[model samples]
Each structure stands twice: as structure tokens, then as C-alpha cells.
Target: MIPGGKSFCTRHYKKVTHCLFDLDGTLLDSEVMYHTMIGQICEKYGKSYSKDNAVQIFGMTDREVSEEVCARTRLPLSVDEFERQLLDLARNKLPIAPEKPGADRLLTHLFDYKVPMALATNSTEQSVRLVSIARPKLFGMFNHMWTAASRTRTSTSWRRVASRTNPSPHNASCSKTPRWACRLQSRLACRSLRDFKPELFGLPPFNEAPPSTTVPIHHS
Candidate 1:
């Protein structure tokens, strides 16, 4: 059973045949680091950055986040300046951020089993590149990856990629963190990912020990 005693539905899980992933808190444990960095930037302008502030930018693109932060904080910096600061901090911090527990393990399992997977994140390609530098093997496992900007530019690309696994979007499971982070929200939380039973989703079971920490998962 999921949290709140929601009955687990094996019927629906059986239909899921593909997986899409988000990066920040999904594969990488860098969501907190991101919030901290934004707060630090806001503090420089004598503004406080709260969870509420972070929530406002949850599903936004990189440029949109910069613009929203600058506007909300009244930070004298232009959007470019604000984004530059974020990039500077990211350069120093993101590469060192650890991958979410079981992330590599799960991805490896899926890859080994020939599961069709893709990455669909709001992060810029540059940010993805930086993070990938720290874990090339893991990132390389995905069949496709797209930034928010790139996704918008090539809207049909997702469909083309999704077709590799199943023709319908309803057949894919989107793996992501927290409910509010995406337009297609799922009820399950990050804690469930750690204890996830692959057999529930008709996937091969893990033959090794589970990781030490929880992983977040969302289905769409």
C-alpha cells in the first residue's frame, strides 16, 4: 500500500511499459542544494527565499526561474546577472552533488533489461552536461534526454522517443520527485522509491541489496 493507505493497484502497474525521468531530485540529490543556492543569492539582496519561493518556480524553465526570482525578490540584478550567479554556484556545487540512492542501480537494472527510457528535465543542456561530467556512465544509459528549451523547440521529439517503447503516453511511467515539481503529478512520494518492488510494475526484480536511502518516483 502507498502512503495514506491507498490500495496498490496491480492492474494499472501491469500496463506501464516505458519510463521517463526527471533529474534534479529524481536521479540527483541536488534539490536541497539548489534551494540553498537560491536562498544564498536572495540573501545577497536582503531578501529571504522560502519554501514558498521555491514552490513558485517548481515547474519553470531556467530563464523563467531567473526572471521569477529577480522579480519576486526585487534583487537589483538583471535576469542575466541572476542566472549567471546561479550558473557560477552550480559550476562549483552540482558536480559534487550525490546521485539519489538506488538511482544508478535502478537505471542499470532497466538498461540491462532493455527497458526503453528517456530523460525529460527542465534543466538546461549545459546544466545536464555539468552533472553528467560527474556520472557519465549513468547519464549515458538513457536512450534520449531533453531540456525544457529543447523540448519546446522539438515538441514532436518526445512522441518520437516514446514510440520506442509504446505508442501511447499512458503506457509510460514518469519517474520524478515531489508532486508539485511537474504538471503531471503523482500521489506517491520519494520515500516509496527506495522500497519499490519492480515486480509490482512488471519489471525484473533487483537481484542485489537495495540502496541505503529512499528514491522518489512519480507515474504519469
Candidate 2:
């Protein structure tokens, strides 16, 4: 969504033919699980992990989160040890994590319209699989799913997905919840799915009421 209307998209972005999405917080409500797990690990080491720590790791990968948590909290465990505990908790918690309110509605609308969509997340493939296992039908709609652990270049990852799904970065739209993650040339950051305007990206709009407000666009 944009306050300036078509002028914004017209002046900058090409008509987006494909959608790229972030997994955590955007689609899955797994942040709580992460917070809980990190808190537990910190407490075990006589330290504390707070909501501030959660915000700091908003778009971080598993290893990155582990590193940050360990460094920030001064936890006694090594990064690898912290990660092993985190992964263990995630394996148990993430599968049962709920989807955000509008996740199904928005994803299904795009899928039914045959719009190319991909999941581009900094999470690991193992993490994504565990989280999506409960809702295979929903997550399966993505034309492609990428994880940072794959060792691919980040920009190249987006471009490859774009070529396979839409053709170019200019013709793609990215949806991310974390502000720091919206560093791409064509990125859209929204607080919720209800604020995402598909028509602005040349995709089919929702059948229900229109978005209530506009969202910020970050392009380089």
C-alpha cells in the first residue's frame, strides 16, 4: 500500500508479476517460540533475554540469533551449544506454531490466481520444513522456497527466484515484516498482510474489503 497511489509504483517499480515472502513473522507466528527458547537458554546461564533481544534477532538466521543471544546476554554456552538447544526447542515448538491471521487468506488468493510466489527467508531449510509441516497445503503453494543456509548469494537468490517465477527483480515484490530485512532494490515492508496491496504489484487483489492503509516501500 502507498499513499501516493499509482504514481509511486509507476515511477519506480515495474509491474510485479511474482511475489517473494519472508517466513517467520510474515507467514508463521513463530517469533514467540523463538523468544521463549532464547529466554530459557539465557535463564539457564543465570542471564536474561527480553523482548528487546527478540527484536534484535528479528530477521536473523539461526546461527546469527545464537551468536547475538550469546554475545548480548553473555551466556556461558558457545554459539554451537546455544544453537543446538535452540534447534531442539524449535523442533518441538515450531511445528505447532500458528499462522498469522491473514496468512492463509492472502496466500490462497495468490495461489488461486496462479501468481508466481516464492518463499525467500534467512531461516534454515530444516527450520522452514518443521514450521511448514503442519500446513503443507498452504506452504506448498510457493513456486520456490529458499533458505539462507543453502550458501547461495542473497541477491542472487532473489534474482534466481525472480527469473524462475517472474523474470526480473523489477517485476517482483518482496514482503518482509522486519525493517532491517527490506534492503533489496524492490522491497515492500508491511506490519500485516491486510496492509499489503496486491494490485499495486499487478497481482490480483483480495476479494474482500480493500486495505485500510498504505505501507512503506523501500527501494535502492
Candidate 3:
């Protein structure tokens, strides 16, 4: 939905040959670490941190998170200070690292399907290298990993979804055109076109989706 505009898309980006994956939340359970750090930083600044407002920034990059901290908490600090605090917290909190459940399994499965994948993370070069140290095998897991700060780096490194029509029709008449093909955006990562969800696009997340085709797998 175009905010308020009824104007529909003349075209759509539907089928995705390549997929971008966010490392922190979408793949790794790093929110607990982030929030704990944020809360500590806010205490030092005498600012109240709201979890609800914090949840608004799950998929954001580090710079985006700093901006949100300023905007949401009205903290009296330059973005640089915020960044320092965040990094300090990262250093203190995450001495060792672990991958989210099913992460490697999913990577192997997607790789087996011959689908290209990239890791788009907000972490800087140093932090990115650190996170990588947590999983050196990650080099074989993804085609690339791009830090969000550098446009040139991310643009060239990460795989871009090639297909232009990731369409899913729900209530819209087959005769009528769709409002959009997909809602992919900056700092947001998505699965491939074949795994796209139609109903969860606009509305609240369903408690559970109706059971669809389930393929049995043998974990050797």
C-alpha cells in the first residue's frame, strides 16, 4: 500500500533469484544482546528506553539504530557517542558467539537449491570480522556479506534478486492489477520468491498459517 495513494504499480518485482539475509535478528538471536546494551547505555545517559519503541528498529543498521535512539529517547548525545556506547556494549556483552537455530541447516538447504544468498549486516568492518570469527565456516555459507555503511561495498558484494515480479494474489480480482509485487526495502531482508507469504504482507502476522505442502527430509 502506497501509504494513502490508490495508484497501483505499473510493474512488480516478484520472483527473486537472489535473497538478502539480515544476520542479527532474522538469522541470529542478537536482539537480547542489543537491547541489554541499549538499556545500559540509556541508564548512563539518564534516558528512559522503551521496549515498544525499541522493537521498531529490529532490522535497522547501526547508524539507523543510533538515529532511532536519538529520535526515540531524545538522548543528549552526538551520534558518534551513541555509536561508541553501542560498540562498547557489544564488546562487553558478546565475548563469544553462537548461531541461531536452523541457521546452518537453512543455509545448506538453500545452497542445495542453487539459490544465491548474501548477508547484509549493520556491523562495521571490525565488528563484522568479529562476528565472522564466531562462525568462520560462514565463508562457505553465503555468496557475500555486505556492511550497510558502504553503498559501493554492499551494492557490489550482495546478490540482488533478479526476478521483477514477486506476485501473490489474495483478494484482488484476477482481472484487476495488484497494488504491489513486494514490500522489500532498505535494511529489510526477505526469503526467496518461492517462499514468499501472501497473507502476511499487509496485515498482522497470523498465529499460524494454514498447513501447506510439507516435504520430508532426512538429516544425514
Candidate 4:
């Protein structure tokens, strides 16, 4: 009996032979730190940065937000310098931000299944290095990683990744609600992405894609 896939596309869900995960919030517990840093940055610029603001930029790259800050608040520092500071802050804080509770277990089980995995993040190469060091056990399974330096970090890139990878489950950054961040209107919501076509959820293109017949049995 094939339980319906979480994504709208049956082809994607049923045929999913691999998994591609977004790094930061998906496997790690850095959402609070991310929210804090965004607050700190916005505060330095005399702008309002709140949890809501952090939520707003959930799936976006820091560079995009920095540009917005420069345009809106006219922040004095260069975006690169600003991003460096943010990364520095994150490095110092990584020890305290734990991995998400169930994520480690999920990753471990997936590894045991010999599931091929890829990690795609909007973070920089340095950030990736820092995270790998900060969470070695968690990152060891990833055979591939894509960072912000890639040509495909834009908002459009987000959509493209989802559309390009058939027979693979697209796991976005895992905040509490799993809603699309302003930058990531590309992928569908977590529930929709589980089996429904993202295009039907206002993220078309993958809309009405072939249906997947296999339902993965997940256990804690």
C-alpha cells in the first residue's frame, strides 16, 4: 500500500532515491542565534529587528538582507564586512546552539539506510567550514554541499533546485512552522513538499508533477 507522498508530485515522492537538505535550520538548532544576530545587526543600524523580521528572512541569504539594510537604513559598513561580523558571531555562538532534537536521529537513520545526501545552504564557504567543525558528526554523511558562493543562491535558484531534482525529496530549512521565507517562495511548505506539487501551493512549475506512489515509513 502506497501512502501518498508529502509532496504534490507523486513522481518526486515515490521515486525519491535521495534527499537534499538545507543546512542551517534544517539539521541544526541555530534559529534562535540567527534571530538574535539579525536583531543585533538591525539594532546597530537603528532599524527594528524582531523575531518576526528573522522569520521574514528565513530562507534568504544574509547578503540579500544586508543589501536591503543598506538600501533602507543606509548602514555605513560594507555588506562583506557586515557578513564577516555575523559569521564571527555565529562561530562564537555555535557551541551553545544545539542541533535540532529529532534531526540528529533522522540523519542517523537515513545514513544507516545508505541514503545518498546533499546539503545546500545559502551560507558561505567559511560558514560551512565553521559548521562542519561545530557539528562534525552531523555533517559527516553529506557527500556534497552547496554554499552561497555557488551561482545558484538567488531566490530563483531556490525554485530551480526543487524543480531540477526529481526522485529526491527537497527538504528546506526547518524552522518551527516550515513556511516559505520571503526569499524562498520557491519551494512549497513542509507539508506540501512532503507529497503535493509545490506549484499548486503558489510555487508552481513542479505543480501537477507526476505523483509518487511510495510512502516512506518514518519511525522515531
Best model per lDDT: 2
Determine which window of 10 residues in candidate 3 has minimal summed lDDT. 1-10
> What TM-score does candidate 3 reach?
0.57
**Per TM-score, what order, best first?**
1, 2, 4, 3
> Per-residue lDDT of 3-112 in model 2, one digit per residue for the tens?
22133334444455567777877798887878888898888889988878888887678988899999999887799999999888889899998888788988898889
Q: Which candidate is the best by TM-score?
A: 1
Model 1: per-residue lDDT, tens digit, 173-198?
Answer: 33323444634555334473567666
Model 4 gets an lDDT of 0.59
For candidate 2, the per-residue lDDT at 132 reads 74
Whole-model lDDT, model 3: 0.57
Q: Clash totals for all models, in order?
A: 1, 0, 7, 18
Q: Look at candidate 4 and tell me the lDDT of residue 166.
A: 36
Candidate 4 C-alpha RMSD relative to the actual structure: 11.3
lDDT of 3 at 119: 70
Off by over 4 Å in 3: 1-18, 94-97, 112-114, 152-220
Full-model lDDT, candidate 1 = 0.72
In candidate 4, stretches whose alpha carbon ends up further than 4 angstroms from where it belongs are 1-15, 154-220
- Compared with the true structure, model 1 gives a TM-score of 0.75
